[model samples]
Target: MIVITAPTGNIGRHLLPLLLEPVPDGETFRVVVRDPARLSDAVRDRVEVVTGSHGDPGTVDRAFEGADAVFWLVPPDSSLTPMDAYCGFTRPAAKALATHGVGHVVGLSALGRGTPVAGRAGLVTASLAMDDLIAETGVAYRAVACPSFFENVLEEADSIRENGVFTDSVAADRKAPLVAVADIAGVAAGLLLDRSWSGTADVPVLGPRDVSPNDLARIMTEQLGRPVRYEHQPTGEVFRTLVGHGLNEAFVQGIVDMKRAKDDGLDAGVTRTDETATPTSFEQWCTETLLPAVHG
Candidate 1:
């Protein structure tokens, strides 16, 4: 049996289907979610839905009962404090896995997580800490150190749709790896099912290529049938923009620092070929998935 945590998230939504298909004979799949009512009826019917928080020891124990492998992911949001809320949530599950003797674990982590910078605290640091905790459990672990998500672009969709322009703090030409959440989930599901590797493996899910905001604008223009353009927002200006959008000051500052890190080549590593050779190309993703999203 495979237990999937955060099964309602972007990656988890795609992952559940992949896991349910091509299963070996009688192996069952289970999903751990806080609220069972939130899961789609089809998903709830297809898999065993275990209701409880990932951080609760009793809940985790029950979810991992009879489970051979697990897929783990932390919810992304500004409300979670880096060390307290984020790492605290993962630590309990990691400890539970160790006690229950689960065979494998797949974690959804981020790129440039091992590095420490002043501004980009919390999520990055907390994820790395979770990776370490999973490793200590002695279970075969694969940490999907994914790049910036392509889905994040949706946040600027309204601006592009309205003014034919998208804005960000990073330079127009600053290239960074971006990966689809589906790709990350696919790899995680594969790892959970295979169970061939041991110890901790860092799998970087790089999108087909490195791209800039300018490239994104061009792609949007072609797909939307409009003259979309990229505008570079100043670092100072980002805080106000995020605040106007209703984000807290800490969260807004963290994003600005993350963009600054991107500009300095913090997330510029090319790991698609090294980690998962079957990487998804930007054009393929844009044509098949992103284009439909814009048009629909």
Candidate 2:
């Protein structure tokens, strides 16, 4: 059996269909979810549902039983500190994985694991630590290391529509690899289904090329058929803005630190090979995803 957590989330939602299109023979699917209602009737009818937070020991214990592989993705809790949000949430599942003897795990993680700033990159640091905790469980783990998602721009759809502008904490000219969530899900699904690989490794899912904030603006302008510009916001301002939205102060600060680390080239260490370079590009994503969001 293969288990999936956060089946309703961005990456998880995409990952689910890929796994279900034709599940391999002798391998059944299960999902640990908080709200079974969020699952479609089609999905609910197909997979075993263990209702509750996957972070809960009891939930994972039941879900992991008889499982051969697990797709692990931690949903960030804005009410908790970054450490608690990632590591603390994952601790129980780590224990359950070992106890259940689940052999393979595909997890969501950020880029910059081996970079100098990685140790100080707040939420990214915590996520890497979580990877370590899972690795200690002796599961054949694959942390799908990723940079910023092209879909992140959708968060600024309203701003783009109204003011023809989008904002970020990174510099306008600073280029870093950005991926589409669909590609991330595709990579994760591939790992979860293939059990031949053993030992822990990071499967980097960098997109076709590195893109800057300015490049994003250019793409948005061209794709949306309007003038769109990039606006750089200070990390501190981002922290305050998010905190004002009622998020935990520490969690907001972790976002700030992560942005700072990105600005400092935290994701620039990896070389994009044929395997690491995913198919989607910023322009393609802007046309396919962002354009619809701005105009729809």
Candidate 3:
């Protein structure tokens, strides 16, 4: 049995179908979510639904019972308690993993190590701490270290569609990797299904190549056939923009700090080698995901 948290999220939503495709016959798939209705009919039909927040001990205990491999992600809590979001949320579950004898845990995290900027990468710092906490449990773990996501561009759909303009917090030439949500899901699903791997590890899901915000603008312009422009929005503005979007102040600032960290090279860990390469390109993702989103 495999237990998935945040099943309706960016990566988890796409991951469900992929996991179902090669689900070695008779294996069980279960999900713990606060609102079961958010899940699609297809997912509801396939997995056992435990309708409750994963932060709640009762819900996690109930959902994880008898489960083997588990997919984990600490849903972004807008509350002031996000420092506790991963550790607090996973506390009981970590115990549950040991008590239930779960074999593997696949988690989502950011990629930034051995960099001075990483120290203040807000949510990322907390997430890395969470990874350590999970690893200490002695359960075999794979922390998928993701860079910026292609879906992040979708957040600027209105600007791109209406005015061929988008903004970010990084410099024009600061190149960093960007992974498609589908690829993150693919990595997690592959690990969850295969029980051969053990021990704690970090799987960096670097995209096909590094790209700057200007490079992204050019790609978007080419894909949309419009004169797209990229602008470096200040960190203060990034904080305001996210807050205006209804994110909690704390969460918004975490994002602001993350952007600052990125501009300082938090994700500059790729050398274009096949080993660091992921399958999707920014253009391919724009065509398949962003193009439709912006056009819509």
Candidate 4:
């Protein structure tokens, strides 16, 4: 049996369907979700459902029984400090992992290394720490180290529509890898299905090309049929804007710190070789996900 968590989240929503597309013979799929109603009728009809938050040991233990491989991710929480937020979530699951004898785990993480800024990279730092805690448990682990999601642009599409502009803290010309969540999901699903590899693996899922906000704006204009522009919001304003939208102080600060690191070139570590490249392109994502979101 294979167990999944966060079945309704962005990557989870994509990963779940891939796991059940054919439902391999003699393989059982189960998901531990807080609310079963959030699952689609198709998903409910196919997989065993364990309704509860996986952060609780009781919930994880219940869903993990008779399971060999598990899909694990730490959901965001704004109430705790960065260290507590990640380590606290992983502690219970780590205990359950050892108790249940689960063999493989696939997790989500970000890319940054060997830089002073990476040491204080707020949320990125916490996520890497969480991956270590899970690694210490002796299960074979794969943390998909992703770049910023193309899906993130969806959050600012409204302002883009209204003013022909998109805003961010990253410079208009600094090149950075921006990935598609579907590609991340695709990598995770492949790893989970084939249980041959062991030890710890950090798979960097950099998208097809390096792009700046200026490049993103140009692509948006072409795809959306409007003259969109890229505007760099002041670093100080990133925090205020997030707070104005009612995000918790902890999360708001984490985002600001991450953006600062990005503007410092945290994701510039990997070059776009065939080995580091993922299949999705920003232009393609704009066509399929962005265009439909704006026009339809």
TM-score of each: 0.89, 0.99, 0.94, 0.96
CA shift of 258, model 4, Å = 1.0
| Candidate 3 error regions (>4 Å) | 243-247, 270-272
lDDT (tens digit, per residue) of candidate 4 on 251-289: 778877888988897888867777678898888999999
Mark the regions of model 1 whose C-alpha exceeds 4 Å error after superposition. Answer: 113-122, 243-248, 271-278
TM-score of 4: 0.96
Number of the top-ranking candidate, with TM-score as the measure: 2
Per-residue CA lDDT of model 1 for 46-134, tens digit only, reads 88888888888888989888788998887756654455455777788887898889998898886675454523543565677778888
Q: Give the TM-score of candidate 2.
A: 0.99
**Every candidate's CA RMSD:** 2.4, 0.8, 1.7, 1.4
Worst 10 residues of 4 by lDDT: 113-122
Q: Indicate whether candidate 3 or candidate 4 has the larger TM-score.
A: 4
Give the alpha carbon lDDT tens digit for every residue of 84-197 in model 3: 766777788888887778889999988985577777988787788888888888899999998989898888899988888898889998888998999899888888888799
Off by over 4 Å in 4: none
Between 2 and 3, whose TM-score is larger?
2
Q: Tell me the lDDT of model 4 at 239.
A: 82
- TM-score of predicted structure 1: 0.89
With candidate 2 superimposed using the best TM-score fit, by how many Å does residue 111's alpha carbon deviate from the native? Answer: 0.8
